[model samples]
Target: MSTPSQLSTNADLRILQRNMAAALMQPLTRHDGLQSRTQVDFITPNDRLSGFQRLEIYARQYWFRLLDCLYDDYPALRVLLGEMRFHKLCRDYLAAHPSTSWTLRNLGSQLSAFITEPKARDVARVEWAQTLAFDEPQKKTLHIDDLLGADPSALRLGLQPCVIALRIDHAVDHFITAMKKTDADVRSGASQAMSQAPTRAAIIKAPRLKKEVLHLVIHRHENTLYFKRLTREAFLMLTALRDGLTLADAVELALAEADPTTDWPVQIRDWFAEWSQLGWFCKPSPQP
Candidate 1:
């Protein structure tokens, strides 16, 4: 319906917008100059600043905001890598995997896989899982009574949306707990108290973390996120249930990997009781 001149204008506007977006994401030079691909005339020069200078301000601010989001999201990684190295890593990561989502919530979603350091990767995985646990919705808690008439042989269950099961090779949860407590103290202005807490510094300076296998359930309860440690048997059972196996089948899978001497029948009963009280189960969603 548009005339030739109007169509040309619309095309020009799209080009301008695309160029501006690219300019905003461009890496700045060491002197803070704009290394932009956008045409100089795209922005008007003001009395106090040139057009490129104005664009540079926007580019720097845009990058800084994204950098800040990652810095906050990956605090443990920041502490482990030190400020300089962490900042470098952030820049490198952003360059490789620029923001694609409108919400910054997903900015660090791929960070765990992007990181190559074993310890740092584990820490990132835990932190990211905690982030998901805190942000994801919690469903109605399936109480034990709801299953009173359910057949044991064919019973299937779903975990709460906020629940995440992880098997990692380091005590990253403990390390994260220490980091969180220290951060809380610093935020509360308890400087002297934090100074006396040796856990933060001790863990940071240790040459290598003692490797410990952990099977953990990260979940949210009453708006608070927590890491619940689980035995390998229980973790496997929960994982199988989460993957749509029948409760009987899930139990069999757990027992397969369980210790021969352990009384798993009793242990599984106790686990279900405890998990039910903690509100971990939900009605499985019907698959299309």
Candidate 2:
């Protein structure tokens, strides 16, 4: 029960809203700024501001809000790249992968793949894994006593849902820990100096980071996330189990690549006991 003119006005408003949203998401540059102003018509200019200028305000704020979200999600990456470069990176990343989810937590979900630098990509991978581990569902954990009595050949094990294993070229874990410490120190200093006049404090240098092959296990326990360094053999065994191999087969595969002189049986038994106690294994399913 609408007139043709009213229906037409509604359609025009919808199109304008869509165009404005699209323009706001683009990079706020001179070229894009002019393009956006030309594409959308605005109300008559008042003494205070022009239509384009008003749109520019909203556009700039939108971009800055997205940049802040990326900064919060990847603080270490931001530190590594410095402020200006991090800002550019966030802009580029957002242009490529716009937010598709209702929640902003998934903003950096594709960051590791989007990053070009190898070291940055490695760090992003670790950070992403930590994010995933933090959100993974809680499950009943296996106990040491359960493994101690099971037959090695017949046993089938499952890793905890919160466990994530990564093999990387750089020792990113050490770098992340160092960066966190630096952040903590800076925050502490700021808190202490709030009442006093600002003074030049000695700058704390970040630890020298080096590239070295590393295998890591990221997992969650009691709502806290942790990173555990693993030996090559241990990584292989755990990966095998994660891939659905029987315990005996996984142990054999691990030993095949391990040092021949080492006492593998004792080593594996100790490793299993430690892992079991840490609740790295998933609880067995109830019998049908």
Candidate topping TM-score: 1
* Candidate 1: regions farther than 4 A off: 1-10, 31-33, 36-38, 181-208
Tens digit of lDDT per residue, candidate 1, span 33-65? Answer: 578555556677989998988877777777767
How many clashing pairs in candidate 1?
A: 0
TM-score of each: 0.85, 0.77
lDDT tens readout by residue for model 2, 1-288: 111223258776676667777767877673435344344354346799887776666776666566656765676676666666666787799889988876666788999999989888887888778777777775787787777767878787888878999998888888878876222111111212122212222333545557999999988877777889999999999988877777999999888867889988899988998888888887534434
Q: How does residue 285 of candidate 1 score in lDDT?
A: 80
Question: In angstroms, how far off is 235's CA in candidate 1?
Answer: 0.7
* RMSD to truth, every model: 6.9, 6.9
Worst 10 residues of 1 by lDDT: 189-198
Candidate 1: residue pairs that collide? none
TM-score of structure candidate 1: 0.85
Q: At residue 232, what lDDT does model 1 achieve?
A: 90
Model 2 TM-score (2 dp): 0.77
